[model samples]
Target chain A: MRRKASLILLALAVFFTALSPLLRWYAFPRLAKIPANQYQDMVLEAKNATLLDYGTMQAKTVPKVTIVQTLKGDVDAAKKIDKTAGRDVVVWDGLSYVQGPDGKMVSSIPERYIFDAHTQDPVHATGEMVDGDPVKRDGIEFKWPFLTQKRDYEYFDAQTRTTNPIHYKGTENFRGVKVYYFEQTIPWTKVPFPKTMPVKGITPESVAKTGTTRWYTTVRKFWVEPVTGAPVYGEELHKEELRGGTLLGDRDKVTAFAGDVKMREDYIKHTVALVKSNRTLVLLMVSYLPWGFLTLGLLLLALSLYLEARSRRPGDPASTEVQEPEPVNA
Target chain B: MRALIAATTGLVLAFALVLTITAMGSPMGKTSPKPLLTTVPAHP
Candidate 1:
C-alpha cells in the first residue's frame, strides 16, 4: 500500500508540474477574460507651459477631453475581421462630452472601438482614433501573467503610420502597489498643418510647394500591476520640433506636453476600479489555480518518492518477498 | 492497495494526457500565428 501510495503521489506531482505551464498559457486567456458592457473612463489634458511651448500659449485655457468607454456586444462578428478568432472580440462604443461655449455640456467625440477580451488588443477603431491611426497592430497585446522582468509591446504611430516597439524599463512600487514600468519612444513625424492655421513663414504659395517643416514626437510610460493588469499610473510626454525650419527656417521648436490630464489627478481611479471590481473568476483562474495544482503535484511527488524508497529497504517485507527463497528442492 | 493505487494513478495520468491532447488540438494560441502581424494592414 505504501509503495502504491508513493507511486501515485510521484505520478501526480509530475502530472501537475507539467500541466502548470500549459494551464497558465491556455487557461488564463479564457479564465481571466474581460467581459462585454464594462466601462472605462480615459481623460487627456494639456496645460499652460505646454500650450506656450507648442505656440498655443495665448489660448488662455487648459484643454481637456474626457471620454467614457462602454463595451456594447460580444464576438458577434470577430471572425469577419480578425480571422484568428483566437481572441474573444467585443464592440465598444464611446462618447466624449465637453463644455460648449454656452457653458452647457455637449457631445464631442462619438465613436466605436473593437477590442479582444484576452489580450486587450484594440482590433478596430474609428473616429478621432482613426484620424491619427496611432495605435498600430494590436498595440497592447500582453501575454498573460503580466509578472515578468522585461517585456516588449508593439505600438503604432498615427502620424508616421507605422508600428514601433514599447520596451520594459523596470519595476517600482507606486501608491502601495508594485508595478512594471515600460517606456515607448515615438519617432518624430512630419507635421501636417491644417490650411486655416497661420504659420509664420509659410505663404499659401510655400504651403503648396513644401512637404513639411514642423514635427512632433511622443514618449509614453506606463506602470501596471502584474496580477490584475491594472495600470496604477501612466504618463505621456509630447514634444514638437521645427527642424531648421523645414517649413521655412533652421531653428527646431520643441514642446513638452503633460499628457492624460485627468489620469494624473486621479491615479487611474476609474480604470483601476473597473479592473478591481470585475473578473472574480478570471483572476482566480489565471493567478491562483495553476499554482495550486503545481504545489499539490510536487507534494504528492515527494511523498511518493519517500514511499518507494521505504519499500525498497532490505529489511522491508515487500523487498524480501520479491526475492524467492532458495526454492524448494528436496 | 496496490491494485487501487495502480488503477487510480493510471487513470489520472491518462485523463491528464487526454486533456492536454484536446487543448493542443483545439484553436489554441500556439496554432494561431502572431495575430497582429498577420492582420491585413488597416491603413489607407
Candidate 2:
C-alpha cells in the first residue's frame, strides 16, 4: 500500500514537472494573443502649434491641435481571413482625426491593418490599406509583439508609407512600471494629401492641380511595457508643410502643422493602469505559475522517493514481524 | 478502497483545474468593451 501510494505521487510529480515548460513555451505562444475584438482610442494634444489657414493660404499659430486616434478590431474580417490564412489573424480598422482649437476638422485618414495576432507580423490580406491606398506593410506598426526584445524593429510609417528602423534606447521606470524606450525619426518626405480634406471641394486632386505638394517629418517616441508590448506613453515632434504650390501663392512654403504632440494626461494614466494589469497576467503564465509548478513537482518527487525507499527497507520492524502476527491472529 | 477512491478523485480534480486555468489564460472568446467611436463623421 505504501509503495502504491509512492508510485501515485511519483506519477503526479512527473506530470507537473512536464507541465512547467509546456505552459510557458507551448501554451503561451498558442494562447497568449491579441483578442480579435479589441477596441481602443487615444487623444493627443499639441499646444501652440502652427497650422495652415487654407482660407488665407498662410500659416497661423493655433492655441491647440488635437488628434484623436481610434483602433477597432474587425471580428468578422478576422474570422474570414482566418479561414484562408490557416492561422490566427487580427484586423484593425483605424482612424486618425485632427482638429483645431475651435473643434473644427483639419484632416482625417482611415486605415485597415491586418497582422498575425501572435507575432504581429503583417498578414497582407486583400483589404490592407492606408489613406484609401492599398499598401503592403513590411513590419510592425501601432503595436509591438509580446515579449519585445531590446533591439531595433522595422516600424511602418503611415505618412511616408515606408518602413524604418525604430531603435531601442534603454529601459526606464515609467509610472511604476519598467518600460523600454524606442525612438524613430522619419525624414521629410513628400506625402499625399489627406483623402478627407477639411474644406469642401478642396480635394487632393485639386491641391495637386495647383502644383502644391505636402511634406511631412516626425520624431516619434514610445515608452513600451516589455511584458505586454504596449506603449504606456508616447509623443511625436511632428511637422508638415505645403511646398512650392500655387495654393501657397509667392510664399516658398507654409507650415501645415507643427507641434510636439503628446498623449493626454487622462489617457496616459489610463494606459499605464491597463498595461500594468496586462503585465501581471503575462508574467503569471511566463514566470510565476511555471516556476510554482516546477517547485511543487520537485518537492512532491522528493517526498515520493523517500516514502518508496522507506517502504522497501528490509530492516523495517513493521515489515519484518507483520506476516507472523497476521497468521497467528487468523 | 476508500483511500484509492479519494486519491483518484483528487487527481481528476487537479487535472480539471489545470485545464480550466489554461483556457482562462488564453485570449480565446475574450472581447473588449464597446468602442466610443464607431464610424468616422464627415468633416465640413
Candidate 3:
C-alpha cells in the first residue's frame, strides 16, 4: 500500500510539471483578446508641401487627423463561412478626415476595412478597393496566439493593393516581457488601379500636369508579445510620389506631385498594464508550481521508502510479524 | 495500522495540494480592451 501510494504521487508530480507550459494557449486568447466594441483615438499628421514652381519648394501643410475604428458584427459578410466559437467576425470602419481650407472635414483615401476578430487582417474593403481582391492573410495585424514561435507574416498593404511579406525580425525585451518584431518594405510600383481615374482633392491644373501616377512605396514595423501575440508598439511609414506625365513613363525630372507622406504610431499601453498584473499568475503556473509539486512529491516518496526499509529491519515489529511462530504450534 | 495511516496521510495531503493549486490557479478572463466602440454614427 505504501509503495503504491508513493509511486502514484510521483507520477502525479511528473504529469503537472510537463503539462504546465502548454497551458499558455488556454490562458492567452481568453485573457488578452481584443474586444469587438473597441475604439481607438489616434492622430496622423499628414505632411503636404506646396511648390512655387515644378521643383521649387514653397510652403507646407499640416493636416489634422481624428480616426475612429468601430466594429459592426451584425452585418453578415460571408454566409457560407462557418462561425467559430469564442471568435467573432467583424467589419470595422475607420475614417481618416482632414479639415480642408473651407473648414470642413474631408475623407481621406482608403477609408474602411473588414477584419478577423483575432487576426486583424483586412479581409475586405469597399469603394475603389471593391474591384481588387480582398486581403487573404495578414498575421501581424492582431493578437498572436501564445503558442506562436518564430514566423514571417504577410501583412497586407491596402494602398498598394498587395500583400507585403513582412519577415519576423526577432524578439525584443518589451514591457519586461519578450515581444516579436516584424517589418515590411514596399518599393515603387503602380498599385492595382485604373488609369484616368479622377484623383480626389487635387486641383485640375495639377491633375493635368500630373496625368495620374499610381506609384507608391511603403514600410511598416511593429513589436508584439510573443507569448500572447499581443501588440505592444507599432509604426508604419508610407510614402508615394507622382511622377510627371503619364503612369507609363519613368519621368524623374517632373516630380509633379509628392504623394501622401504619413506616419502612424500605435501601442497597447493599457493592454500592457493588464498583462503585467497577470504575469505573476502565469509565472506561478508555468514555472513555479510544477517544480514545487515534483520536489515535494519526490520527498514524500523518499520518506516512504526509508520508513519501509526501517520497519523491515530484522528486529522490527513488521519483520517479527512475518517470522514463523515456533511456540504457537501448541 | 500506523504504516497505513502515515502513507495514506502523505498521499492524501499531496493530492489535495495539487488539486487546490490547480483550482486556485485557473486563469481569470481578462476584460477586452476598453473604449471599444459599441456604435459608430453615420458619417456626415
Candidate 4:
C-alpha cells in the first residue's frame, strides 16, 4: 500500500512536469488569438491645426480637429479565408474619418485588413486593400505581435501604401506598466485623393482633372505593452498638401492638413487599464502557470522519493517482519 | 480500485485545466454596443 501511494505520487509529478511545457508552448500558440469579431474605436485630437479650405483654396487655422478611427471584425470573411488559408485569420474593416471643429467632414478613408489572428502578420487574401486600392501589405499595422521584441519592425502606412522600418527606441513606464517605444517616419509621398471628399461634386477624379496632386508625410509614435502587443498611447505628427493645381490657383502649394495628433485623454486612460489586465492574462500562460506547475511537480517528486526510501529501509518493521516460532510438540 | 480512482482523478483534473485555460483565452462574445459614428449628411 505504501509503495502504491508512492507510485501514484511519482506519476503525478511526472505528469505535471510534462504539462508545464505543453501549456506554455503548445496550448498558448493554438489558443491565444485575436477573435474574429472584435470591434474597437479610437478618437484622436489635433489642436491648432492647419486645414485647407477647398472653397477658398487657402490654408485656415482651426482650433481643433478630430479623427475617429474604427475597426470592426467581419466574421463571415474570416471564416471564408480560414478554409482556404488553412489557419486562423481575422478580417478587420476599418475606417478613418477626419472632421473640423465645426463638425464638418474633411476626409474619410475605408480599409480592409486581413492578418493571421495569432501572429498579426498580414495575410493577403481576396479582399485586402487600402483606400479602394488593391494592396499587398508586407508588415505589421495597427497592432503588433505577441511578445514584441526590442528590435525594428517593418510597418505599413495606409496613406503612402508603403512599408517602412519602424525602429524600437527604448523602454518606458506608461501609467505603471512597462512599454516599448517605437517610431516610424514616412517621407513625403504623392498619394491619391481621398475617395470620399467633404464637398459635394468634388471627387478625386475632379481634383485630378484640375491637375492638383496630394502629398502626405508623417512621424508616427507608439508606446506598446509588450505582453499584449497593444499600444497604450500613440501620437502622430501628420501633414498633407495639395500642390500645382488649378484648384490652388497661382499658389505653388497649400497645406491640406497639418497637425500633431494625439489620442484623447479618456481613451488613453482606458487603453492603459485594458492592457494592464491583458498583460496578466498572457503572463499566466507564458510565465505564472508554467513555473508554478514545475515547482509543484518538483516538490511532489521529492516527497514521493522520500516515502519510497522510508518504506524500503532495512530496519523498518514493515519491511522486516519478526518470525513467530512454530510450536511442534515432537 | 484505489489505483483506478487515482488515475481517473488525475485525468479529470488535467482535462479541466486545459478547458479552463482555453476558455479564458477565447474571444469575448459581446459586439459593439453602439455604432461608432453617425452617418455623414450629404455635402451641399
Candidate 5:
C-alpha cells in the first residue's frame, strides 16, 4: 500500500512540474488576446519605405508614408468653410461630439483636420463650400456655441482606454477571408486637397467670414483570425463615397480605407516558430529523465515485496511468530 | 519505506532535468517584428 501511494504521488509531481511553465507563459499569453471588435485608433508608422515590383505591369516604387486609422464615430460638432477667399479651409472642433458606432459618447481626440490646400498658406480662392453648402458670411462670424452645440472635444491618451462598452458586430468578409468585425477609433494624417486657381491672394482675415466646418462619421470592417484568436486585419471606407460627381473618382476626394492583414500574418509565423522550437518540452518527452523515476520506484517496491516474501520461509515461519509458554511450566 | 524514498528521489531528479531543458530553450525563442504598411492619402 505504501509503495502504490508513493508511485501515484510521484507521477502527479512529474505531470505538474512539466506543465507549469507552459501554462504560465505560452498558454496564458495566447488566452489573453485582444478582441477584433474593440481595437480603435492604432497608428502604423513605417520605419522605412518598402519596394513593390509588379514585373511587366508596373515599375518598382517605394511608397514612403505614414497611416492614421480610426473606427467610425459620431460628428458631434462641425464647422464648414465652403467659401474662403484665400484658402478653402474646413475646421471641425468642439467637445459635444461623442457618438461612436457602439452608441457611446466619447470626448477623447487628437487635433485632426483636412483642408483643400496642402499648405495653409495664403492663396487665391475663387469659390468655397462648407459641408457641401456655400457660405456667405456678411461680417464677424463667430459660431462656437452654435457650431459645437456647446460641447468640448475629448483628447485621446497613449494608453488607448475605451470610453464606451464593446458592441460585437457580426462577422463579415474582408478582401477574401471571412472574419469577425468591430468598431474602433483610429487616427489618420490629413491628405491636403489644394485648389490652385490664379487670382488675387487674400489674408486669413479677408475671407475668414465665409468659412465653416462640420463633423461626419463612417463604418469600417475589422477582420480577425478565428484559429489564432488574434486581430489579423481590417479596412475602412470613407463616409462620403462619391467625389467630384462621379461613381469612380479620385482617391483623395472619395474616402480613406486602411487594413493591417499582412502584418498580423508575420507575427503569427514568429509565434509558431518560437513554440515549436521549445527545448523543454522536447527533452522531457524523449530523454532518460522520466525513465529514471520509474526505475527507482520499481526497485524499491520490488525489494520490499521480496523481503516480505522471504520472511515466509518454511523453517522460519513458526519461529517468526511469538507463542505464550504453557501454564504447566509456570 | 525504502521504496517511497526511491520514488521521491526520482521525482526530484525529473524536476531538475525539466528545468535545465527549459532554460536552454529560452534563448531560442523569437518574437518577429510586426509588418507595417502606410498609404499616402491620395492628393488631388
Candidate 6:
C-alpha cells in the first residue's frame, strides 16, 4: 500500500511538471499580445516622470516624452501609429530654475498647468508666483505667491536664518505652438478648505509637512488643453511612512497614483503580450514540480531496497528460506 | 518480495514512459504563432 501511494505521487509530480512547459508555450504568446493600451500607457507615464537623485535633497526632475500619434496629413502610411489616445505623458520637472530678481537662477517652487486627456495638449496654466503673503488659515500656514508680483521672493532671511518662500515649478511643450514654464510659491498649510474648489475633498492643512501622514494627498499635477485651457488629467503622487521593522526607517515614501489620462490602445496590446509570456513561464514551471518530486522519491525507494537486499548474507535464513533449502539432509 | 518490488518498479517506469511519450507528441513549442485578436467590431 505504501509503495503504491508513492508511485501515485510520483506520477502526479511527473505529469504536473511536464505539463508546465506546454502550458507556458501555449499561454505566453496570447498573454504577450494583450491590447497595448492597458500596459504601455502606464509604463510610458512612469518612465517619463521621475526626480533625479531620488533620495537626496538636491534632486532634479528629468521628464521625457515619446508620443505615438495617428497621422492626419501627408505622412508615412505604413508606420504603426499607437491609436491609443491620451497615452502621452506631459512631464513637468519639479526642480526647474528661473531667473530671480537679483539676476540669479534660483530653484523654482510651484506652478500649475492642465493637459487634455484625449488630445494631450496644454490648455491653461499659471505663469509663475512673483509675489505673495504667508497667511494662517488652519493650524498650519505658509505663503501663497502670485506670478505677477513686482519682485521675486528671496529664499533666505540673512540675519534670522529662516528659509523664505519655498517655490515649486513646471514646464509644458505644446507641439510647435508654445513652450510655457512657471514657478510659484506653494503654501504649506493645515486649514481645510470648503469643498467648492477644483480638489473637492481636500484642505490646506493636509499639505502641512513633507512626510505628514494623511489619508490622501493635498498637492497634485495636471495636464490641460491649450486652447480652452481646461484640465484633462489630474494626478497626485502620495507618500507614506514605512513600518518599524522594514529596512527603511520611518520616512515619507510615495505610495500610489490614481488616474491614467492618456490611455493608449497600442500600449495595452503590448502589455498583454508581456503578461502572456510571463504567465506561460509560470505554467511551465508548475507543470514540472510534481514530476521532479516523484523521480526523487522513487530513486530513494529503489536505493533503500537495493541496500536491504545487499546487507543480507547469501546463506542467512532471510535469503535461504526464500529458495526452500534444497534437501539439505536428503 | 523481490519479485513484487521488481514488478512495481517496472510498472511505474512503463507509466512514466507513456506519459513522457504523450507529452512529446503534443504540439507544444517555444513559440505559438497564433493570430492575435487585434480589432473589435464597431458598434452600430
Expressed as tens digits, the lDDT of each residue in B1-44 for candidate 1 is 66356546645774576466645543312111112111112220
The TM-score obtained for chain B by all candidates, in the order given, is 0.51, 0.53, 0.57, 0.57, 0.51, 0.52
**Candidate 1 steric clashes:** 10
- Compared with the true structure, what per-residue lDDT tens digits does model 5 show for residues A1-330? 433554555554444444455434443333222111221233332223322121221212233223434432112211123243332233322111212222232122222222222122212222222222233322111111111111122222111211222224666654444445555443332221112111235222332332311112333334443333234454433221112322222322332222221223333344334323432343344333435434554555565555545555668653275557868863
Worst 10-residue lDDT window, candidate 4 chain A: A315-324
lDDT of 2 by residue, A1-330 (tens): 667677778767766776777779877887888999888888888999999888887789999998888888988889899999988999998888898888888988889999999999999889999999999899999988999999999999999989899999999999899999999999999999999998898999999999999999999999989899999999999999999978887888989999999998888888998898899999998999899989987988898888778887898853443444445563
B1-44: candidate 5 lDDT, tens digit per residue: 75456556655665575556544432211222221112212220
Name the 10 consecutive residues with the lowest summed lDDT in model 1 chain A: A65-74
The lDDT ranking, best first, is: 4, 2, 1, 3, 5, 6
Question: Which parts of model 4 have CA positions greater than 4 angstroms off?
Answer: A318-330, B1-44
Off by over 4 Å in 3: A1-59, A63-80, A83-133, A138-151, A170-178, A192-211, A242-268, A274-330, B1-44
Lowest lDDT 10-residue stretch of candidate 6 chain A: A70-79
C-alpha lDDT (0 to 100) for residue A59 of candidate 1: 21
> Model 1, range A206-297, lDDT digits (tens) per residue?
74464435567778777777676656666666665444444434335433222343343453665555445543445565557678877877
Best by TM-score: 4
In terms of docking quality, how is candidate 4 classified?
Answer: incorrect
Ranking by TM-score: 4, 2, 1, 3, 5, 6
Where in model 6 is the C-alpha error above 4 Å? Answer: A1-291, A294-322, A325-330, B1-24, B27-44
Worst 10 residues of 3 chain A by lDDT: A50-59
TM-score of 1: 0.57
lDDT of each model, Cα atoms only?
A: 0.51, 0.85, 0.47, 0.86, 0.32, 0.30
How large is the interface RMSD of candidate 2?
A: 7.1
For candidate 3, write residues A139-252 as lDDT tens digits: 334344443568887665655666667778998887677777877788877654322223344443454565654466666776766654556666555544554565325555
User: Residue A111 CA error for candidate 5 (Å)?
Assistant: 12
lDDT of residue B30 for candidate 5: 20
